[model samples]
Target: MVVNTGLYAFNVTCAHRQITPTVNSIYGDATPPNTPADFEIKVASPSFTRRFFRPQVSFYCDQHSPFKPLPLAQAYALLEWGMNWCIATHDHTRLLVHAAVLVKNNQAIIFPAAPGSGKSTLTAYLAMSGWNLYSDEMAIIDLESGFVSPLYRPVCLKNNSIDLVKQWFPESVFTSTWKDTHKGDVAHLKASSWKQYIQCKPTEIVAVIFPKFVANSDLKIYSLDQLQAFETLSKNAFNYGVLGNLGFKMVDKIIKRAALFEIEFGELCDVQAFLSEDIIR
Candidate 1:
């Protein structure tokens, strides 16, 4: 089946129906046909060559699998990760960054953080609290326009956050938790409405925030100079090296226009208050 994510499309073949509802929930009601795709992928049960007792499933992109097979129950999460890999490795038209993009009052903020930095948790909180969700993983930056497009997929949660978000937003829909993956307990918060998926225009970015989840800490906000922000963003970007000079120019432009900050917080209310009183306006 071909999945058209508005900006890019791919053809995927599944070994079983395990990934069906996940694809449906993430992409909305319309199913992509099995047409010609930008990239072809498959998720199937791994061969018993190792003769291990555990059942495993592996994802293949254009007949090539990058990582080893995972537990059978994590097929859906593997598919999502595989799709992200396909885009990161192949998609060069947009300046892909390992960042979560969210917008409010016509202004967007991009959060670039390493794993365990609370990026996705903050994204889930802001997205549920009325901010527009562009993406929870990759931020597709239009090189020419310097605007970020919406992927409108699910917000991935890991470990304790899966339950934390569930308790916070009882109405939010999420996939079954897949435990013991490389990301440690992975689940995706599905796009809440079709309107969100259809609101696909590239949004202007106003801030670049590096969020750090500091336990039992007061809200600490620090300014990031353009050079600091640029260096950090370049490290987090997926296609910067592939895009060459175009990538440099684009990142430079982005740094000039957006306010850069590093924030450390323990509570969601502190984040909400900060963004509302200071950032959003």
Candidate 2:
């Protein structure tokens, strides 16, 4: 099956039949016929006997299997992760950052946070609240224009965040949680529809926010200097070293134009209020 996610087309062969419903639910009516896929991938049993024994699924991008075989239950999740890996590893035309891209009123902000920072949760909230979710996992920045483009993908929530998001937005569509993965209790939230994704265009980045979630704390916003922001962003980038001079120049340009800040907050609403009233205005 060819899953066309507006930004990239993935030709996926799923040997695990159970993974199909989750894929279909998340991406409905987005498939385009005869469209050449950007990556040819598959999620199948690692070995002949494994299919009948323990039942593990392996993600293969063409001839290479980037990840080890996971349990059959995580086939869809593995496929999603594999797709992200394919883009980050293969695509060099754009400067890709390991960040969540969210846009409002044509102003885009890239949240480049480490794991356990509640980045995904914040992204899910903003996306559901009305902000255009460009890409939940990556910021597709144009090297020349320094603008960020949207990718058709779901926001991945893990552990406690899964229930928190479900409680916040009960009507939102979510995939079945795959328990005991590398990232424990993981689920993917469909924050925006395909129509919203197609309407999104590359927009100039207005801010670079590094958010950290603190338990039961007031909003703390710290301004980051250009040098600090540049260094941190470079480290967070997937292909900074690979892109070399081009990547350096692109990061420099973005820092020059974008307001850089570190935000530590306990509540998503507080962060949203601060951004909407102060930064994005």
Which candidate ranks first by TM-score, i.e. highest? 2
- The clash number for model 1 is 0
What's the true lDDT of residue 99 in model 1?
A: 96
> In model 2, which runs have C-alpha deviations exceeding 4 angstroms?
31-34
Instruction: Provide the TM-score for each candidate, comma-separated.
Output: 0.94, 0.98
Per-residue lDDT tens digits of candidate 1, residues 228-251? 999999999999999999999999
Spell out the clash pairs found in candidate 1.
none
How high is the lDDT of residue 27 in model 2? 83
The best candidate by lDDT is: 2
lDDT of 1 at 20: 77
Which parts of model 1 are misplaced by more than 4 Å? 31-36, 48-53
Compared with the true structure, what per-residue lDDT tens digits does model 2 show for residues 1-281? 88877778999899977888888898875748456788999999999999999899999999899999999988999999999999999999999999999999999999999999999999999999989999889999988899999988999999999999999999999999999999999999998888778789999999999999999999999999999999999999999999999999999999999999999999999999988998896
